[model samples]
Target: MPNHVAVNPRDHKDLRILEERSEGMGDATMCCITFPEEFRNLQNHYTILFQLDQEREAFNCLAMFGLENGENLFLDNGRWDASYVPLAMDIQPFMIGRPSDHDADRKVVIDSDSPRIGKGEGRRIFDDNGIPTAYLESISNKLSHLDGGYRASSEYIDCLKKYDLLEPLSIDVTMKDGAKNRLVGFHVIHEERLNKLSAEGLAELQSKGYLMPSYMALASLSNLSKLIARKEAAAINV
Candidate 1:
């Protein structure tokens, strides 16, 4: 559970959030939510794939790390050993909330229970004059980007579905202990099908700037081997 309240300068003028990156910051996720806007950065480190949100029946992109839940092989010495961390992971403890009434407004709320919410060598949310600090402004911008990203991602997901490019995927991992791990219920873009699209169809997608990320996601599949190596290394230490 989260204790989220509306942010106000009067009550939270001295709010100093810990700005550190660690598994404790809720970055120890096997898969982090991502959008098409981050494909280039995300592809460099993790495999990008789409998974079905069974409740909403919508397709969403994800940056995969390990084969099982709570198994993020990207963690090294309690630190995220990656050149790039997804925006979704970078902005933690703070989240955008929507109103339930007819008025559609988003509120900025922080998870009170988060370890990041203590006074320390972190970011100061407000200044002496009660104005937002530079760090706080950046967080505000990120929240706005997230809202836009969700809108753009909805369009991107539709684009992939309209062309039937998404294909179901099941990854089988052979662990060092001779145990088998099967990752199922995920989907990836079918490269063959994408390549086989008609000239007109390809032109439409290329015009929309959707083709590049599709290919990038396909390219990222190779990093799964890197994940396997990571898993192996961790197992050796144990």
Candidate 2:
């Protein structure tokens, strides 16, 4: 099944209209990550996750507000038996962010079991430099009392704030009870100045079918990046 069909065949013109009328953010591309068990058959951009969920789909969605085709897709699949959607790009920079031995002290705990976390085994830790990372058993004894996953470390969040990039934006989960939950997970730390794009930047982005973007989406990725970097640094230094 196709992901999105224009209500009007002439809506193809709307793509140009959308390109020109896109506000807030200059031009955003769709970042769709699918879980093999869910969206193994679907492959289309601009589809709604909830609708996809209703259609028995399983995929994560992100509006990559500012990106060029050649950029890396940095992501971590913390769960087992999970397949990450490939961005059809080079794998040089794409890595599974994990924890480290130095973080043998850091832990991730959840309060409720009703949510039924699947990948509750260990933590992926990053090194100080934020490049290479490792994984270890979560050490926090207090985590059994919290709901959802534990909030990422403050160190991770602060660094993400510094880079000023877009985040995973949203999470769409279809529970066992057939209910879909859209958790606005990450904070949108920055919003684009749509009315303020420089003529040159806009022209360049437009010509290349890319936009440098004014706003950035943020999530726990910064911490994951931090943990990876920290672990790599620790390993190298050791």
Clashes of each: 0, 26
Name the lDDT value of residue 13 in candidate 2: 18
Question: What digit string (tens of lDDT, one per residue) describes model 2 on residues 1-238?
Answer: 2132211223221111111112121112223332212222222211212112325322223332112332222322221111332221111111222246755543332222211112422222333443223221121211221111112212223332344423335645443445444545333333353335567645654454323212112222333333334334434554
lDDT of each: 0.82, 0.28
For 86-107, candidate 1 gives per-residue lDDT tens digits of 7777777777877787387787
Q: What's the C-alpha lDDT at position 49 in model 1?
A: 83
- The CA lDDT at 211 in model 1 is 83
Cα deviation of 178, candidate 2, in Å: 6.1
Quality of model 2 by C-alpha lDDT: 0.28
- Candidate number with greatest TM-score: 1
| Runs off by more than 4 Å, candidate 2 | 1-43, 46-180, 184-196, 207-209, 212-238
